[model samples]
Target: MTGTTWDILLLGGASGIGKSRAAARLAAGTDGFIVEFDDVVSAVQAITTAEHHPALHHFDHAPDTARLTNDQVLALQIATAQALEPAVLGVVRNRLTVDTPALIEGDYLTPAAAARAVDDGQAAGRRVRAAFLHEDEPEQIAANYATREPDDGDQTERADVSARYSHWLAQQARTYALPVVPCRPWDTLPARIREAVD
Candidate 1:
């Protein structure tokens, strides 16, 4: 292990808020590895048949939650996020132990949790930054989701949930003093993200 802290950039935000693109740009510039929480959740779900597994109950698992209403699905999504904290933090710890820089991006990486990592002894002498992206209009966010290739459930419902999540994320960012960037049009998101991390 080196005596330097590893560079880990954490991007958190609502769905369809341009976090994916921002992460891609950062990774391209910094040669950083990307660790997405949704991918992590999917990987966990593939190997588990646990009925109580949080990810299994998420709205993304449409087949399983076919009978659930949008509100129920949203509740399950929140629960799954809370349940994944330990796993996400563990991944961060392992990644930071290595020399390579990493960019951990996803909706589940809350500002408070990132702040805990930011203040840890492991982050001393190294850069550990976090940013949250948000879109003011839920309709615009819904439109972004509607544009995705692989269609999921109702875009409007997802957007509504995303809007609520964004507000919550903003509060968390404020509480942790993390940067909250607007990604409405995503015209300058990558640049703004770079500035925030720097």
Candidate 2:
């Protein structure tokens, strides 16, 4: 496994866009693990509770509780990236050592980060592939939000943020040449990922 490894599959997308589901299926079918980026951030936030500050809203009319400033979000994102590094590296190393594969599920990896990972993986004798998920319609994503019922704290405003994130992700994927997988529904995503992985 240390010789040359398969691509490090990264599934990134808007919340509730089936990135996790696709990653789960990939992991189930291959030798991989699921690393949820949001979970990593939450864990860091809990540990650094002392440093945690109220997030400022982006919109002027946004609810007082709903605003999260760019600086605040960037801080959280950096912390999350730091926390995820060791974990991600561990997975990559383990897979390489044992000649296995890893399917990492997260949204924190910006296109630049993805490219960096690709370079690092290649240097370490492993390939890296990125997949960005996209939802065809906002209505479907809203329905998914209703079904998931994510926690009230970070994801309470998911319905609105998801659209923004999805659009941003799509643009990033196009700009970075990352593969974009359009997910129509939960049932269809696993098969698509399977095809990609296979």
Candidate 3:
């Protein structure tokens, strides 16, 4: 095992629930490292572009691409996961050199994957914890989504996604026995996250 010691803290919940914002605060306050899933997506997009094959070109815009079927998007997600696994392992193994925690923020990591990450970190003598953030109001989430630009890649027209994800996260929290941190007024999310991490 690598000599570096770290903790894997995952921030997952409904979209626009302030997962990324909380992660940034955690990193700043604790002098820890942050690994954001969107950055991983961007890197995967860049790698797909470098390969530049017709079959892989569909990944350029991913789920947003109108030409690709649902099956194709699923395939791309699988491929990206496979490609990222090694890099993630490497980062966990070699990049972290301090005892500070590592925060991984994403809504996409499955329950199984998150459990595996925690197990792996424990096996390496590092502490790990997973938290799910939730917001009670659907209208609040809708307002957040509405603020995004029309051309923003992360834009979603359907506010149901946020509500659906909140329900899904709630179930996951119960199933996994993870802490459910309720966030509101978005501005105070950072303090909430700090308290959770503490």
Predicted model with the maximum lDDT: 1
Query: lDDT tens string, model 2, 1-198?
Result: 122134567677777777776776666745455667666546645564333432311222234533675444434444444345554555445555554566667766555556556666778777776677887566777677767765533443455556566676678777977667788656778667556534
Better of 1 and 2 by lDDT: 1
Q: Candidates sorted by lDDT, descending order?
A: 1, 3, 2
Worst 10 residues of 2 by lDDT: 53-62
User: Whose lDDT is higher: candidate 2's or candidate 3's?
Assistant: 3
- lDDT score, candidate 2, position 74: 38
Residue pairs whose backbone atoms clash in candidate 2: 56-67, 56-68, 57-67, 57-68
Candidate 3: residue pairs that collide: none
Best by TM-score: 1
TM-score of each: 0.81, 0.68, 0.65
The C-alpha RMSD of each candidate to the native structure, in angstroms, is 3.9, 5.8, 5.7
Please state the error at residue 69 of candidate 3 in Å.
14
lDDT of model number 1? 0.73
Candidate 3 per-residue C-alpha lDDT over 1-198 given as tens digits, one digit per residue, 9 for 90 to 100: 122233667777767666777777667746567877667656656666635643434455555655655445445544544455444554445533456567777755444455556667777777666677887776767667766434554433334456566666667666866667887756777666556645
